[model samples]
Target: MTEKSMLVVSAHSADFVWRAGGAIALHKKNGYRVKVVCLSFGERGESAKLWRKGPDMTIEKVKAARREEALAAAENLGAECEFFDLGDYPLRVSDEALLRLVDVYRDVQPAFVLSHSQKDPYNFDHPLAMHVAQEARIIAQAEGHNPGQKIVGAPPVYAFEPHQTEQCEWIPNTFLDITEVWDVKRRAIECMAGQEHLWEYYTRVAQQRGVQAKRNIGITVKRDIQYAEGYMRLTPAVVGDLS
Candidate 1:
């Protein structure tokens, strides 16, 4: 049997750590090699904490700090991290960048993919990342898209929960009970020193999702879930048996 792999595409360096660290850690524990692609370092817009350190912070400085944080976070989750370094603030995904993502899709040949929500009013970059991820997935599956490169298999794509779920129109259709890996996720969350305010917020989100997961299906399984992550599957799942 072939080895299973998972891929996650994020708009910013810290986005994956905040949204999908639990899922990444859980899958890695289950013998899947996970890869993360960060479109940008979010240096300009998302580095408020670093920026507040007086006027000495340069773009390079911010990028370096965010990259370090992201690397630490990915390491905590047992995943490999790649950075595109595309500038943010008004995060734009160029055609070249999209092609790079296509290359990643072909290279990883991920069994499943995770990305941002399709719509996010608070951060347009989040939705843009989703668009690029979707397009890259489609292109990667087509043999003719790149003449010399081998096409990749179709993988189910799941969008992780956004910060403001209601505003983003993100509904959680899948809940992963990550109770056992919550500590790992917490450690990953702490790696983002530039975004200290979000640590507790995401932790609370996990707990709330865990409560919802418990009410929804935990009772049936007779399991107690203290932490969970929610996702919206964007692709059809094929299985030998529905159960």
Candidate 2:
């Protein structure tokens, strides 16, 4: 049997941990190999705690710290993490970087893809990441685009929740019940020491999503869901059965 796999394209090193740690952990527990690609280390924009430590903190130092944290977080969730090191004050994705991402899609042949929301006015990087992810997915699916490499399967793309869901205009069409793996997710969250302030915020987000999941499924099931992650499906799902 072929092994199941997932690909997550995050704009920042710690974005995956914040948004999809539960999903990653749950999928890993279910026998899926998860691969995370962080387009940028978020050293410039997201490393407030590290920057606060010293006035002369170099970009390399910030990158190193964030990379270490990201690796630790990925480890806690049983996923492999890779860095693009694209740099991020305004997170730009060059043509080379886009091609590299397309290469990853072909190589991994992911069963599904996760990425940032298409609209995030507060953080421009999030939207740009989504754009690149979508383009890469398209290019990867075209057989003629890269003649030597095998064309990838058409995997559904899911946009994980942003920090400010209301401002981002994100709607959750998929709610993942991650109650069993909440501990794994929390451990992953704790790994991101630079962003300690967000720990409680994400935990609460999970709990609220769990409540939404419970309501969406109805009250008759008697589920005691304590944590969950929500996603917006960006592609049409092809299913064998309606149920």
Error of 2 at 11 (Å): 0.4
lDDT of 1 by residue, 31-52 (tens): 9989999999999999999999
lDDT of model 1, residue 100: 94
User: Which regions in candidate 2 have their CA more than 4 angstroms from the true location?
Assistant: 240-243
Clashing pairs in 2: none
C-alpha positional error of residue 98 in candidate 2 after TM-score superposition, expressed in Å: 0.8
Best by TM-score: 2
Query: lDDT per prediction?
Result: 0.93, 0.93
Put down candidate 2 lDDT per residue, 17-77, tens digits, no spaces: 9899998999999999899999999998999999999878888998999999999999999
Give me the runs in candidate 1 sitting further than 4 Å from their true place: 239-241
